[model samples]
Target: MEIRWLEAFVAVAEELHFGRAAARLRLAQSPLSQTIRKLEKELGTTLFDRSTRSVALTPAGHAFLPHAHRVFEELELGRQATRATAGVVYGTVSIGFSGALNHLTLPPLTRAVRQRYPEVQLSLTGRVMTGDGVEQLEQGGLDIAFVGLPIDPSPVRTRLIGREPLGAALPIDHPLARESAIDLADLADEGFITTPAAAGSALQELATQACVKAGFRPRVVQEITDPYMILTLVSAGVGVALMSSGVAGIMPSSATFVPLRGEPTYMDHALAWLDDNPSPVLKAVLALAEEVLPTPER
Candidate 1:
């Protein structure tokens, strides 16, 4: 019915907790609960199953979630198109990016903006990890960011641009480097190099989870923010590192990237910005990115 109703529904569905969802929306728990009740009555179906201990999405909620997302996406597109037609496209947009994206997604997007929207200037900050990037967007310090995916959606709007399976970066002389592919369980005892947990690296999370699934926790020997430095450490035989398969092209000569066998671990790349950001320059860049940076085929 109302946009607020959809907003409450989506938030509650994502969090699966009324209190957390209310906190995320900056609304009182009572009001949020009422909104959901009103929405359910209007739709003639229950959206969530609530109990004293836990909350779960009902079948109807699961079916309606994607449609709610599409409604917001279409509304955003309409606003961007209207602004573009108004020709208010000249302004500076600040961008933040993690080290992993510097060589992958950032270059082409920046180049396209430079060529097409020369009147618009970009101020860029490098080596900002996903958590930091999301914070910057919420704080209005960054107009947009290239960040790792699966971040909290409550803070910013995001569009997924790329994804790839993670692989191991090992010293060329390492025994596993000689194999075409190795099981992740094989490296359980080996020390690993990864980005800092505080940096909010999606790769670090995914790799750790993969290792756990393979029946062992990764023994992290070092933490580095820069993906290149992580690879360099691997080359030096300091510790093995888990990296995106897409980054193999940039690997150092002393390091070899080996794909992980069995269940795959993937890293998703995305562009994020505050949904309320009204900069026409940001709108123009987003439009251009839509045209130039379509998700790569697997």
Candidate 2:
């Protein structure tokens, strides 16, 4: 039976009088009586014994009253849950990123989101991938991604939330490290620590391209996967690699970071999500990412 029928049955059962039940339900007496009859008809049993003067629950009405109460409670809960999910409350947002994730000021951004949308549970994952983290977002596995931007994406929406300039991760005492500002050309003959090209790391590709623009194809002395490993290699004098300016934050004490000129550097690093209807939590996280991530001086 319909929710209205159940409500009328409960109201009439509680009041035990036609006029009083109608008043409690904000319905007229005749309609209230008709509603109770429909519920009884649907159930093929008399739920209430009604006379011209008073109303009383039959055996079936007594049996059904508790069930009717529970049904209305469930409907109320469903409406509340709908409202929560329709907005930003009570959701778990999954975010993905690449190597420069830590460099994008995400920890602070995440903290802000936690404080503001406390009900929106956050799950953050970092993967070193060969593709723009956009693909996972498209497949509904990720709500947003932080990665190098100005990326040519395949049917995804991207915001360039940060800009990390090119810097060198070099041993502090290395001859080139002494330069106040290094040019890409200065490192043309230097050995390089490279990441695997097969993993679709755009940042690694950008570093190699910077070397090419500076007049030398880098000699890859090591192929390491992690950004931490990249810095370690540089500190040990295995090679000097072009890196995000924020690399300085995680660099070893033995290494130095210097701004590079003519570096073919990237100014737009990205936060990306699917082009489909996105969740409000994703939107909030994007706003926080945009707020915290810094841009280059253009």
Off by over 4 Å in 2: 1-88, 99-101, 130-132, 262-264, 293-297
lDDT of 2 by residue, 102-191 (tens): 554667777878887787788887764436366676666777777665556477777666667777889888998878887787777788
Candidate 1 lDDT score relative to the true structure: 0.87
User: Which ranges of candidate 1 are over 4 A from the true structure?
Assistant: 1-88, 296-298
Residue-level lDDT tens digits of model 1 in 105-177: 8889999998998767799998788888899899768999888779976659888898888889999999989
Instruction: Please list the C-alpha lDDT of all candidates, in the order they appear.
Output: 0.87, 0.73
Compared with the true structure, the alpha-carbon lDDT of candidate 2 equals 0.73
- In terms of TM-score, the best-performing candidate is 1
